[model samples]
Target: MQLKQALASAVERLDAADVGSPRMNAEVLLLFVIGADRAYLYAHPERELTSEEAARYEEVLAQRATGMPSQYITGHQEFWGLDFVVSPAVLIPRPETEHLVEAVLELARGVQRPKLVDVGTGSGCIALALAHELPDAEVYAVDLSAEALEIARANAARLQLDKRVRFLQCNVLDPVWEKTPDVIPSEDFSPSRGTCCSEFRDFDFVVSNPPYVAFSEADKVQKSVREFEPTMAVFAGLHGIDVIVPLVEQAHLALKPGGWLALEMGYSMREEVVNLLSPTMWEDIRVVPDLQGIPRVVAARKQ
Candidate 1:
């Protein structure tokens, strides 16, 4: 079938399923199936798709119709203007999280070879972005799920960033509670490997887009997100501060004096994040708003 006809059929199915942005979703799935870009699709609307291509397109459309995220279907997402591999094992990188990256860059402004840690580094988005921008900086990415860490490590390899950002499996950058992985004992990264101490110490920055969506607010989340995305990457206890609070404290221990912590929080989390950093131990705290003018990132420095 022609690309246009297949796309139209997919859009109709997705729309009937009550999916938002059906046309774009359909186009993405079709392009993914046919291995073509939007320009190619438009330039060759009458081009025929082979039987296998048509079948693949319809299969992805069916998944989208069932509320599966298009990103998950494509196994890819664009973050920091770079394509990242994604799966149900990790949270899909969102645009707002880029603000977290921006905040870190602004704060890290003139520092050379700064050391940074990304806690809850699902898909290694924040750490990879930072390492790309600051090639000389030491970047460490940690996550609780070993599965998520594997995908993150794979993404780093795909992007030629694996050599810069090291990946670890730990919750919130806490002291390694368990034994070390095979990568331990390397001088440059021994601490992140597993020492069970303040091995993560003295980082110039700590950044994260931690789980900030409250479980009670599940109804506000989109159908695809609730059903298809990983839940641990979304809900953070009742108030959503469950993870952020601990991350803030850990950022304190890991950061050197004058180091900064940059975090992306829920739109409703500005006050709580502010209060959490209100203590004298933290200073230069500031809130950054996204394009929508909602408070999307909060940055604070260790005192």
Candidate 2:
């Protein structure tokens, strides 16, 4: 079939499926199938697809019609201007999460060879991105799901950042300790914290884009997001701050005296997060908004 005609049909099908960004999705999938770029599509509007290419494009379109994310179909997503391999095993990296990386880079600017850790580092996007940008820094990525860690490891290797970041399959930063207990210790550590837990200490920063969607809010997400993406990477608990609440305490214990903790939080939970990082344990608390001025990132320095 001719390129223009095929794309027209694909768009109509996607629109009927109620897929968002139908035209753009159709064009991207077609381009992916034909091994061509958007400019080439315009220049060769009369181009005819080979039988195999036509079949493959149709298959992708059918998949999209079911609300499978295009990123999963293409096995890739772009974040911080870099293309990342993505799959159902890991959360597809979002553009908003780039702000997490930006906030980290900005805070770590003056720190030399900083020790950094990313909690719940699903695709290793935040950690790998930081390691790529800060070659001298020591980077650690932690996740609870082995499948997710595998994806993260694959991405690190694909980006030629394999040696730059360490991947650990554990619950958050708990693996960093010398002898991490089964349960997370109390927030108000006894100063003898390291004696019972990890000896790893003095992190320059602990960053994360943790799960912030509540179970009840799950239905509010797109069908693809709810059905395809890893659920633990999306939903936290009843309040969606299940992870964030603990993260604030963990980050404080994990960072150096003046180190920073940066997190990408839900826009509506800004005040709750701010309250979590009260003046006693945290200082220099800042909430960074994305392009739309939504409070997207909450950063604080350990006092």
Off by over 4 Å in 2: 176-178, 181-199
State residue 184's C-alpha deviation in candidate 1, in Å. Answer: 10
Clashing pairs in 1: none
Candidate number with greatest lDDT: 2
TM-score (C-alpha, index-matched) for candidate 1: 0.93
Q: List the residue pairs that clash in candidate 2.
A: 177-198, 178-198, 178-199
Q: What tens-digit string does per-residue lDDT give for candidate 1 at 175-220?
A: 5323434323323356456464546788999898898898889999
Against the true structure, what is each candidate's TM-score?
Answer: 0.93, 0.92
The residue-by-residue lDDT of candidate 2 on 56-123, one tens digit each, is: 99899999898999989988898877778888989999888998899889988888999998989888
> What are the root-mean-square deviations of the candidates from the true structure over C-alphas?
2.8, 4.7
lDDT of model number 2 = 0.86
Model 1 scores a C-alpha lDDT of 0.85
